[model samples]
Target: MLESVLLAGGGSAGHVNPLLAVADELRRRRPDVRVVVLGTAAGLEAELVPAHGYRLVTVPRVPLPRRPTLDWFRLPGRLRAAVRVAGQAIDRSGAQVVVGFGGYVATPAYLAARRRGIPVVIHEQNARPGLANRLGARWARAVAVTFPGTPLPGAQVTGLPLRPQVAELVAARHRDAGRARTEAAALLGLDPTLPTVLVTGGSLGALSLNTAVAGVAADLLAAGAQILHLTGAGKADAVRAAVAAVTRDARPGVALRYQVREYLAEMHQALAVADLVLARSGAGIVSELAALGLPAVYVPLPIGNGEQRLNAGPVVQAGGGVLVADADLTPQWLRSHVIPLLADPDRLAAMGAAARTVGVTDGAARVADLVEGLA
Candidate 1:
């Protein structure tokens, strides 16, 4: 009997995407329930939330200061201000429950919701739970985690919620794999019959991924494989030049098969046509690939808290995907490993099937069910 819910998360797509997915599922299940989003004006949610047709209420960005600095000294007043606005938003929306997805806005939203005696549910997107979610989990009505071993008390493994497009792709692929591939290939100007490899380093591009994959583009092309390389932002020119340098002496029409784009608005089409994926193993992409039953070579980013590597560990162990270190993904590595995998259709299909076993496509529905029970 939930009349309204406030979904809180922002700063990155990893947070906003899942929040939106759960919001969509909640709306679909209970059309009359009011859905409102709480985010910072500076985060990606500012643009994406409104575009998704949700009512977005914003608060001032209040990043937690890790060390003693000006920000740390000012944190108290800033947090208080943010919490005040969050409470105002909760009151205005008449939110019966607050759903937090772990970002700067989450801390304040959690505080506000708890102070108002409203229930809160949390969804932690990463294997390593963030500070916001760590705090929220202390008294959340229910906790949902994308990765199995995420250290949250009383957390249920619900997997990452897939975007509508990705969920639709999963359903379509399930209905008819070959027809789905053909239709997606036509949309992306790819040949459905040819083995296709998708290489991406996220929206801003990964230097290690782009350089290593581009260096080996000719090897992949020579193996009768087509590439849909989404070079992030301005990295395409450099990748195109590297591919040209490597394949200059190759036979004609081989270069045509190497399509390098800066970005793709419809990512599901790219996912639909890919037989294998070579990319960074972010939580979102790892969950998406698993849900779609796509085999992948996950090159974990070398930076951060090493969560990317941890994120890919379970799927790799399950024989669904291969985890490669960022520094280890060289041209020589591609020649030794990736090229042969691309040539083996049986192995690719087997790996795809294995990935499907670890994936959960109904994560949004699961989270919605949790919300409904608590609300």
Candidate 2:
């Protein structure tokens, strides 16, 4: 069997989803291939990987504390344990190649593969590479990037690999525009007569985005626009409470149409129905927006990493969306930016059209080709 190992960990859907996408693509190209994923027991991978039909190998790994603390003492032990687990997994799987999608758990897997003389590849999804991927790059046979300008040598810009549902949505738009819109709306429970705005962070959701959208819920409702909000599990209750307060204070007889969920299992439904999107500009999110022909109001996280900001630039420049600094985000600014587009159907349509022009639909195939060639 052609064996490959994918190294990804942590509960963040952002990291896990991309690894899953690449795995799916790899399977499509080579059905007989044996793919094993290495992650931690504490991560979402425990649930997500097996649900996607892959064998998951878990290790005991903990993240380094942000500040100097007693946890620092455990770092060395954890690293050694992780490395041992990875070595065992690699040997058991007999992997020919190891692909890391960048997380704390990826380090050990990469190192194990290197020790065993197996070829290693690193895929960096952010414009600014994460620390794990940066460290892994030294041993990587090749590095894959999602954005236009990443500075690693032998790095191929393969773009982000979207889920199959997203790819189908893009294809449908090209083949039959009206049918695509109608079908998307139906799938999302959206009223065909009303304009829709999609609000989300990554798969987990952004607190600031949720707060700002909550503050402006009244205005959006007054204008007869609908909302699809994905509040991360941790903050869903708070966001729902805020929305309730907004609805309670709204004018009587006006229906505030919205659907709020802790996670979006059917992302295609949200993307299909969205005329405008309010979100943070992660590289993966930007790629999906571009692929689906959805316009967005991008608020780059103000963490000073510059990754989100870099990801949003192309879409803003393409006239598909406006970039608002996180510090500049307020209910007033959101209302101003979103209200006009909702009121003007032509402007929304134009933005969506422009956004679609920026997507690389064949990203998965390209990355898969790279991985397959390594074998």
Candidate 3:
């Protein structure tokens, strides 16, 4: 087993969530190993890394320049400085091995570990490789990926690392779905018997999803399916306005069926009770939906090399979800496709049953095992 290790990844929940999942697994399996996180003070890791009981070492944030400019000219010096800082952190922690999840922190950590001749492992959470992990894969001792056809050299498909709470909920959902859903409903203050549809577009919310789904709020609620719409922070006003407009001059109690939340900290409960999800197809969210057996309507973000669409492909192909284009998401689409799907209990259940086939719950442990061996 590794005596001491350095974990490098961060900037967003996509990177840090998996890093923390693997960290939790390692500590659970072997309590003696010392773990340290390398990240930036501004990244999400600033709070999560220490909260998880690991020493955190921070460095300056250096994003790889995409366009040629003065910033591009200064890239080499900035990266060299970051690598030096990362090397110091590695030495100070006495880390026997370094594990990097794809993020700004990854490249520097990988280069520093290589300099010290330390074992380095890379984890890619998406089907399409990010620049950091794509480069790191070449020299990594081992590479783990969450999806197949990731195009990483020597890649092992280990699936996304579900957080412990999420993993347990997923396991419970698989074992006793009825009870799990009931408990989750109670936790989220939802009607245990009501079929609920969950809508979320990540932390900041997706305007397209929020607008389209809210446009059909009255229709969905009238169909006897309660809607739990998490309209990420700062965007709740827009969703509420949309729903209000839709429900204007409508029958009494029409709005009662729709619940709009700005953000949900207890997402596990939301996952537990959801019969379907209407959201973005980010790799992490897709993995969660698949692991929890929640059917989804995936709207790929209209940016970034069409990666989100690719992330949802396998699950959609497996009949676990539906993939809709960003612009095509509208009131008509929701009424035509979403309403009927919710109304069909047989189809919903069938999709839910198939979800587990597209995702795995053992990713944290699997990645831990891979990194442990390297250590």
Model 3, span 27-136: residue lDDT tens: 88889888999999999999989988888999877787667889888879889999999999999889988999978888899999999999998999888888898888
Which segments of candidate 1 are over 4 A away from where they belong? none
Q: Name every residue pair that clashes in candidate 1.
A: none
Model 3 clash pairs are none
In order, candidate lDDTs are: 0.93, 0.81, 0.89
Q: What TM-score would every model get versus the actual structure? A: 0.98, 0.90, 0.97
Q: TM-score: which candidate is best? A: 1
- The TM-score of candidate 2 is 0.90
The candidate, 1 or 2, that scores higher on TM-score is: 1
Q: Which ten residues in a row have the lowest lDDT in candidate 2?
A: 1-10
TM-score, model 1 to reference: 0.98
Q: What is the lDDT of residue 19 in candidate 1?
A: 95
Superposing every Cα of model 2 onto the true structure, what RMSD results?
A: 2.7
